[model samples]
Target: MEWLARVMGARRAIEVGTFTGYSALCLARGLGPQGRLLCLDINEDWTHVARTYWRKAGVADRIALRLGPAATTLATLPQEPGFDLGFIDADKENGRLYYEEVLARLRPGGVLILDNVLWGGKVVERRQHPGDTSLQAICELNDFAAADERVQPAFLPLGDGLLLLRKR
Candidate 1:
């Protein structure tokens, strides 16, 4: 992610599922000086831990965290001079919605990475069942992204899976 940011020369970014902020730190550090990152996550406890590390890493001021539903928080962000990248790894059910919102706000040629897309390989299981909600959600989101015309999409065989989309 840091490499991607550097390659794109990205100065503004947002992360939908901050978790422990490891990804955020990587993104923030890559932004370097005169850049800003917004982190959206619902868990206060985990974010607290992230804040501590961000301070130690000296990137705390570069990142602003919001604690709430990612969609709700993303709506609060402005559209102009939009984000260069978006990393999604939050609630599986709302992954598609988050992708749509982020895509709309991302600048041209920007990227959006949806993580855990393979769902431990359940996405391609022979007897895939609807009972596996996360798997179903990932399948649906993957289909939507592939079929969408606004962005060029590619799937990477990484940990679980990664769906990379670059907005046209």
Candidate 2:
């Protein structure tokens, strides 16, 4: 994750799910001194843990954590396209909506990273619980991204699966 951000020279980043802030720390390490990271999550306990680590990592100043529904926070952001990179790992049912919002905010050369697209390989299975809305949403998002020409999309078989979308 840090490598991708560094290689892309990302100065601004947004992360939708910050469970303990591990990924946020990784992404923050790539930011320039003046860069910023906006982290959104609904779990206060989890973000508390993240705050501790962010301070320990000396990146607390660069990170701004918003505790609430990610969609609500994203909606409040200016629509004039501001981010250079974004990562979405929140509720699967709203994955496409999150993607649309993030993509619209991303600069022309920015990137959006979507996690759990493979759902631990269950995505290719014949049977799945209707309650597994995240998996269904991820599958739909993958298909949608692949068909969309505004971005170059690819699914990487990493932990679970990661969908990389780079805006054209």
RMSD values, in order shown: 1.3, 1.2
Name the weakest run of 10 consecutive residues (lDDT summed) in model 2.
126-135
Give the count of colliding residue pairs in each prediction: 0, 0
Backbone clash tally for model 1? 0
- Please list all clashing residue pairs in model 2, or write none if there are none: none
- Candidate whose TM-score is highest: 2
- What lDDT does each candidate get? 0.88, 0.90
Q: After superposition, how far is residue 106 of candidate 2 from its true place, in Å?
A: 0.2
Over 4 Å off, model 2: 126-130
TM-score of 2: 0.96
The candidate maximizing lDDT is 2
Estimate, for each residue in 92-159, the C-alpha lDDT of model 1 and write its tens digit. 98888888888888999999889998888888881557687777888999988999999999889988
Candidate 2 global lDDT:
0.90
